[model samples]
Target chain A: MSDSVVLSLAEADSLAREVLEAWGLAPDHAAAVAATMVAGERDGCTSHGLYRLLVATASVEKGVVNPAAVPEVSEPAPALVRVDGKGGFAQLPFSKGLPLLVEKAKAKGIAAMALNNSVHFAALWPEVEALAAEGLVALAFTPNHAWVAPAGGTKPVFGTNPLAFAWPRPGREPFVFDFATTVIARGDIELHRRAGKPVPEDWGYDAQGNPTTDAKSVLDGAMRTFGGHKGSALAAMIELIAGPLIGDMTSAQSIAVDAGRGGSPLGGELIIAIDPAGFLGDRVDEYLAHGETMFAAIEGQGARLPGTRRLAARRESLAKGLAIPAAFHAEILDLLQKGKDHVPNPPQGSRAGSNGAGDGSGGH
Target chain B: MSDSVVLSLAEADSLAREVLEAWGLAPDHAAAVAATMVAGERDGCTSHGLYRLLVATASVEKGVVNPAAVPEVSEPAPALVRVDGKGGFAQLPFSKGLPLLVEKAKAKGIAAMALNNSVHFAALWPEVEALAAEGLVALAFTPNHAWVAPAGGTKPVFGTNPLAFAWPRPGREPFVFDFATTVIARGDIELHRRAGKPVPEDWGYDAQGNPTTDAKSVLDGAMRTFGGHKGSALAAMIELIAGPLIGDMTSAQSIAVDAGRGGSPLGGELIIAIDPAGFLGDRVDEYLAHGETMFAAIEGQGARLPGTRRLAARRESLAKGLAIPAAFHAEILDLLQKGKDHVPNPPQGSRAGSNGAGDGSGGH
Candidate 1:
């Protein structure tokens, strides 16, 4: 009657693991991928949480994703590490490359990791937060399939293009913020359309470059970047730096290759990690302490740091477990019997592929 | 009859040089500093052009800037370069640090330069453009004196933090973008106030955290980030990385130190450079060529890249020369005769110094 089911953290984790493994993922990769899903749920990022399992299952069934692929890491340069995800999910490659990235960052003051050929479905905060946990400042970026347009353009030339950053906080959780450059997630638009509601005028433009509040029109057209041109510029930066700079596919290339498979965003992710001690030497503690004043000022004025909500959610969820929608939970169970039984909709208007513009992958 | 004059770029350069030399800057430092003002002029950025000369003269006369300080560089780590400006302008430190940064990037695949104890008065594009010219992708950030508030807060706790980036385009001008995290320059708002005009409602908030278009009240209060919370997060990132990571002052720290002599932003700048050869190796050309398609898509849709105007201005200025304001040019002349005769008002609000909220230093 409540239309929801409460499950323990362990149960949710097992559920995600089973879904991936059942869909043909190897045990090691399945575990690595499952951790991100569990973490997303624990942090109350429901959009990226357990719902992602359905998307992954769909991709695997459609043969758009390589479920058993092993991530391979190589030292492309002294301060650069390259991780070929072998056309698999990004989580495995990211985990494989973290050690080398952390090592190089510590040795050289800064270092970068380029994860290419991966299907990225996870939110980036977890990737950056992991590096921050190792006492390093981290910034990460990745491009989704092209769906958002440049500020003045009517057609899609850019992706949602998420940028994530984490700053180390010595005694507590790191400061973190990860966000899509688009005004809102494509999934949100789909939800709006499903609810038969109109969206904000600025959310997107139709094919004729006219502003529209119709969710359906936007889904069939292009999304706008947040913050106007500033956000648009940042989105472009993400596309290039994480795209061609890594010799991986751009969002355009990815979506073209996806061609309607409704798989996760397939491209490259660039992660830069810097060791503060490398720059500040023995004075790292002193300077970070000084940084506290700036932090205090933001909160003292009644504003919140971006990561505050996520951290709070993590704590509450860990203590009480995850409460997931009953229907979505049933779908996960159905996925065990038939991986294709529940497929999230594919993205719209970026050549919606065979799925015909269904909102698959939860969100970009 | 005309308020503005069309001066040859050389005239602007020479005028700037004479003012700096008269203010006690060494000839080498003066030449190095004058180049940025001239470049700003050439690129049609009048606010950062010859007008900055008066501000520099004020900083020197007030003893807040060390006009003759020589920048010193050191390599504390293999891929990290540090430049100590010794309280001089950032231009000198950036130049002194660039060679090593390029070398490290070429060797290590990526490198970073941290500039400390510098006065930053110019736009950031030049710094990144220089790196891009070296065939490297680049990113740069610096914190000015605190004048912006976090999106939901009513206090000035962050600088008009600027983020700059450049990507190489082989055989053509590199794609580039440099912008402040704030909605607009503090100087623009000052210009609005001086012109007795109301700014856009979202530009800033007044003392009770109410949205206000009154330029004076907003200036007396706090400016907003360009895109609400997203921009604020970026501003905070700029403060931490360019601030604590480099062992220099955060905007809050910088403003408190200023107590207000209306000097330039005294702080640190972080520059990261990456070599394409390092990532794509021999395939660099192939990938960069592939990147052209993305650019074509953007332009095909009638959208211009951020650097298109600057590139056009640079070519036009190089051919025809700079068009400077006659009033501002005459003010530079006045400064040479009496150091503080024509100081740009320091940045408004954020604790007006002994100068008493006079808009010295033009803007943050």
Candidate 2:
């Protein structure tokens, strides 16, 4: 974390969008990506924010992402649709596809849209959270680069595949529960590596299934499931439901194929949006009554609703303007400088084997 | 687990429904409850089957459930409806509510239904699996009775709330994933108590936050979360999304509330069903293509998907008939014999407590 001059939210987003455009993403696509990344930053999720820009840009330059590719929507029913990413940037699928599903859900009680052949998008909460803000409930699952192991084993058989869900509540923050079903997310591991720190031993295991605190050991080996077999079961179940059920790539097939980056083949995603009013009607009037009574009973006890922490965080962010490291601000400036220097040249050959662009800076 | 008799599926359903009727449930409601419970037996979920008859019957007889209650459906959209269970049996909500949701989903592509004020309805997988067999994908979640602790600290704070999702797979078994978000379910603890055995130390914590191998400790205290804080967070998240978000009660306010027994309130459930053909269309053709390739790769490495084991158990039950222990069989007969006894003219307040319940001889 650099301690330098702070960047306003607008300045940070401007730089990110410029860098994305330099990577050959269209204006609209670049803006969408920039918005999500900035939202993550503003919400204190620095790991998923601007820090991821360089690698995403590199993927685009390598022809792995089609700047102008259109998402092909295959609508099978009024409530169901499939968006073939068409080798396009992932931002398009999440931004364009999610709203479509939300629209259908608003009209028809519920809607589910699946995206196949897509790249890794940003965190899922923002998309679902936005829907919740619109008074709709949304749940989305994304299976990405593999890292999680199965229960009772140290095999890297699943991804940190995060599951996210959001529900709009009257007179309160929308309840959004977003988490990776792994002991730790890949970004957390990278953060440890960057800081030259060892992880807790139980967070991961080495080749012989021995727990290790060494960051290098976890990087070289496999990450444990969040709750042993339960988490692994969830990851596998998510893959079966989100991928196979939705006609996306399976984890095994995703691993077998090379996805240009030498990273785990990016798989697919499933998003379900629900219009609460469509189902609850006047019953929506009862939520505040029910929730208040329940929360009142446990007030000041060791119980808080799921979104309370996030809500508290958001409150603090709005009051104090999202506490960010000065070092990260400097890194953002450096990326802006690099984008200005590199122009729009397409990346040559496979830079995939390397752990992203070796700038030691983060932003996507 | 009645070993003295091997009732065919039809016979078992008939007898079970007959027993429910004797407890004052309407004929249709009794049949629905019996059908769900018998299906659990058929699917080898012995823990949730006929062994639970006494608890269900007690709830009805104690006036905790309304025998003549009818679920009310309120539709807010073409694809969504809310089913108010009216403090009735869980089967009432499913029997009358699910078909409506399914019908709308078939026409509109998706349906979201929230079932509120219903008692425990046994394991959720059977419900979703049945829907999957009808060529739909279903996701079901219900906040349950608190019996397990959150990840870190000791003391029970969350239920062994199960999340179950089933997807329709062409030319293969409908992949189903159902699991309780606890280290060990309460049923397993009762099993240990009945067998005069102990649980693994790691499975639970005493009231002082120390690990214990004694099953009684967990029953008197709390079972630890499976993977520390992350598991607790997951359970907490589930309670918020599956409970409060659906206009139901959270665990904090639901402690000591037994949905199966009388005088205790039930929690809420949210079920989302989707018509895959509406979403996948021609891509449904690729479901197996992609999933098989992935499963084949994992198979090459000896990895199996979650729920594959349950499928195997189901097949065996079909082939060999449902298995039941001789002792358990006798216990059921004994209960039936008690129902037949001429002690029907007991005092108004006459009811058996833990001590009068046959020493819990059939717990396991």
lDDT of 2 by residue, B1-364 (tens): 3345677777778878877776667788788888888877876777778876777766665655666556677665677766676666777777687778788878877777777666664788877887888788788887676667665356666777778888676678876778777777777887898898989987887776668888888777777666665566566656755665555666544444443333433656778787765655555556645555545544555666667776787688677766667777677667666555422322122111211101101111
Cα lDDT tens digits, model 1, B188-229, are 999999999999998898877788999988987899998888
Q: RMSD of candidate 2 to the true fold?
A: 7.1
Compare the candidates by lDDT and give the number of the best one: 1
* Candidate 1 wrongly placed segments (more than 4 Å): A1-3, A340-364, B1-6, B339-364
**Which candidate's TM-score is highest?**
1
What DockQ does candidate 2 score? Answer: 0.35
All candidates: TM-score of chain A: 0.91, 0.84
Q: Each candidate: what lDDT?
A: 0.83, 0.66
**What DockQ class does candidate 2 belong to?**
acceptable
Error of 2 at B10 (Å): 3.7
Q: Write the per-residue lDDT of candidate 1 for residues A222-309, one digit (tens) a residue.
A: 9999988889999999998898888777788888777766678777899999999887888788778867778899999899999899
Model 1 lDDT, residue A254, Cα: 80
Model 2's alpha-carbon lDDT is: 0.66
